[model samples]
Target: MRGSRITRLFRTRPMTHETPYEADTSRRRPTVLKALVFIVLMGLVIAGLLAAATLLRSEEGPKIAIAEPEPLAVSVIPVEYLTELDIDELFTGIAEARRTSRLGFQTGGRIERIDVRVGDRVKAGQTIARLDTRGLGAQLASSQAVVEEARSAHQLALDTADRQRQLQAQGHISQQRVDEVVSQAATAMARVDAAKAQADTIRVQIDLASITAPYDGMIVSRFADEGAIAGPGQAILELVEGGALEARIGVSARVVSELVPGDIYTLEAETGPVDAPLRSVTGVVDPSQRTVAAIFDIPETTGVPAGSIVRLKMERKLEEKGFWVPLKALASANRGMWTVYAVVGEGEDESWRAQPRLVEMVYPAGERAFVRGPLEAGDRIIVDGLQRVTPGARVVPREVQRAEAASGG
Candidate 1:
């Protein structure tokens, strides 16, 4: 009966706020809310204790400090600023003697002797070779005999004419007889002159058969040999004048305009480099080659031989506003523009970063280039280890001295 009564008390029906069941429910609701609040407060206290334990554990060990990355060490060189660059142009040429001659005998005859070989050096007036004058000796002797006989007859005629004139004066000879003796003497003297002229003609023929070098030269070729028959005007030997050399080069009009005659210039030869003076410039351009001829006279003691391949080195001003930079410092970029890694900083500060500058390569000069655009003087640029660098990267640049850079450091 008591348990039934308790069940009835726990089981309540809907009623007005003034009923006992309503009062009990209200009181229980307040107690349950308080218990729920206490449970949440206990959970908060436990979480706070756990957090404090974590803080104590974290503080028990040594602290670690984060470190920044080290800067890359690189070699750098300053941009060599310049407004002009010399464009070296080499024109191919041939070294030749100042004078070349093809020597020959004036008259046709058999070559009796050849005193000079194909490479013999001879001086002026040196007899190179001579035609065999032995065959003409008999003819010369005959001429001489005729001249001597004529001279003897001419002396006899004079004596006879003198005797006749004396006889005519002494009245021992007629005037017509004296006149005939004078005429005979005059005829004998004419015979002597004719004989002397014949002998002189033979001597001239002998002189014409011989050959002599007209200048100091070397025999470059021999077209005729001993015992070979050569005609008049046929080349017997080819001679090139020594002690003077010249280069004949063809150059464009633009290049020729930059050259001045009588200026000293250097030339490349098989032997070595030689200094030559500009002798002349053919101002007219060739119709076929469209190039003008430039003549340079080499020094006598240069040891450059004739017929050697040669070259003329000419530098023309490009008149460009650019600076010189090593090729290693240049990194190719987009749209044909090139980038260079330059280190910029306060002059005395060691903290420098790599800054990329856009440039145009105007000319390529061996290991260097002429560049312009977005670059300034005194800007140090990274040269070594280009493949390992990037823009705005921290770098420790070791500046390469000007002398070291020039020596290919």
Candidate 2:
């Protein structure tokens, strides 16, 4: 009875299924939660410290500083004023005589003698060449004999007419016979006149055999030699008249209108410059060249020879109070608008400032340019460093002097 009671008691003991380990884990659950919370708070604190350190490092980075530019060094020139400026038109031409002639023979014959050679100077009416007078002399002699016979016959006719008149007046002969004698005398007089006229024609032919210079000139060429046959209209010699020389040049229509007679021009020869004048202007336009012929009378110069190649600079008009500067000084900002920079003054700190000024081009005077602008006498211009300069840009001005004086400026 004691063993059964012990077994029943053990089986029916209420079945309480709880261990010591389980009770210990259930008791530490709140502590584990507290530990995880502490770990999360520590991580947030560490992240905040790292972000603050990064911000401090960024604030200490490198800094940038912009540098100032240096002042540019440049050269300048001053504008000038003039009383008269020449609008020169330059053209190339050849020197020619005022008059030229080609001497030829009127009568065809063999050349007998040559009196002048190439480069030989002669006066007007000077015999340059002579044709063979073999036939011409004989013809002249025959004509002369005929003239003399005609002269004698004319005197005889006059005497006969007077005699016949006297006989008719005295009635010594019949009226019919007197009339016949008078008619014969009149016919004889007419024949004498005809013969004299023929003789004069022959004399002219004889004179034509000798080729003579029509004016004072120098023989440039001899076309016929001794014993050469010269025909009528055949050129025997070429002559250029000596006195004043002239240059025949072509000018554009625009230039021609500006030119006037008696205007002075300068001709550049091999020796030097020769002063000349505008002699005449041709109204006819050359269809091929589109230009007019302008004749300039050049004074005779011993140093300059005829047929020389020369450069002619003609002054079409004069521009009073004009300024000139170098070609490099010209600058263009907008289309068809030009300007130039002028050096105004040096600052207290030794820096130069340039002022941009607009200009109008009058004309080109040789290598320089004649201009009209808001520039006064003795104004400095920036010639060398124009591109690097602005209106108010600081510059270091350096004076540039020209080698020669500007012409027509």
Candidate 3:
């Protein structure tokens, strides 16, 4: 019991160096445990960052796809009803004088002197040329001498008849002698009158030997010169009536009926346009051309000579119902037919479809056409960008303003 008590007393005594070292180890153990725990938490945070980076590298988010192409944008125009159409037609014609004539003398003779040359203007009743009058002068002088001699013989016979009548009453001469003297006087008087008539006939021939102008005119050509022998009815000069210009145009019956006589119309001359009066129209149709001759009196100031080519323009109106659309809007279809695409629905969100309408071309004027089809007024038709447009194809409607050209030229 005493040994045990001594040992217990020794254990209860103050600590030594080894004992201090054990207490120090126990204090540092908590710090080492805290450091280990900090290292583990940092490793867990790094692991979480690595996992997030791997998820970002993978292409697992929402994807993007190319959008469908937008509908073809096109230009369009509104079509309307065409009540009537006017077609312009140009007719060819020639400018000429109102009266063209070949002038000659009434009698055959040698031309003495040509008073006028070609392109000479003359007045009515003016002498243009003369023939030799030497032969006529001699014959006229002989006729005068015969008339004088016949008159002297008639006076002598008359004196003899008076004396014989007085002698018969006095019974100195017979009545037969008086009758014979009276017969002689009558025959002489007849000869005198016949001679005078012959003289007058020669004088008239002298007047007819010369060429005179029948009216105011110009000589366009000369067929006979001075000292040229010309026969009657042979052309000596080509005379055109002066200051009277005209045009002879051949026109169709349809056009001829529409033109009224005395109405003014326009003509394209060599210089420029001129207004003239319509004179007449021959209803007789030419077999070759199937046209009638229409006479228009042209103004003299136009300076158009004969045989000059001229032009006449006219507008013909036809009664028809149709629509005018751009040529670009037309598309060829089966069996030689044409079609146009018309937009039916009219809204941004609405589905507008290209509907083809069978169209018959009434007339084509330049880049536009007048057509008749199964369509209504205010129908929208695609004009440009036609390559992308097709029948029954969905399209985006973009309208364009344009003027309707319906005139057929």
* Candidate 2 per-residue lDDT over residues 181-279, each given as its tens digit: 777778777877887787778778778888888899899988879999888899889999998888888878877777788988777887789878889
Report clash pairs, candidate 2.
77-381
Clashing pairs in 3: none
Positional deviation of 11 in candidate 2, in angstroms? 99
lDDT of each: 0.86, 0.80, 0.84
Worst 10 residues of 2 by lDDT: 400-409
The runs of at least 3 residues in candidate 3 whose Cα sits more than 4 Å from the true structure, single-residue gaps closed, are 1-84, 319-409
Relative to the unseen true structure, what is the C-alpha lDDT of residue 195 in candidate 1, on a scale of 0 to 100? 94
Regions of candidate 2 where Cα sits further than 4 Å from its true position: 1-89, 151-172, 314-409
Structural RMSD, model 1: 22.9
For model 3, residues 1-409, the per-residue Cα lDDT tens digits are 9999988988999556677788899899999999999999999999999999988787895567998456666677788897988887777899988788888887888888888998899998999988888999999999889889888988888898888899989998888888998898899889889988999999998998888898888999999888888888889888889886889899888887788999999988887888889999999999999988988998777777778888889898978999888888898878867989888774685667788888988888889888898988888888877788777677766531122123331
Ranking by lDDT: 1, 3, 2
Candidate 1 global CA lDDT score: 0.86
In model 1, what lDDT does residue 222 have?
91
Which candidate wins on lDDT? Answer: 1
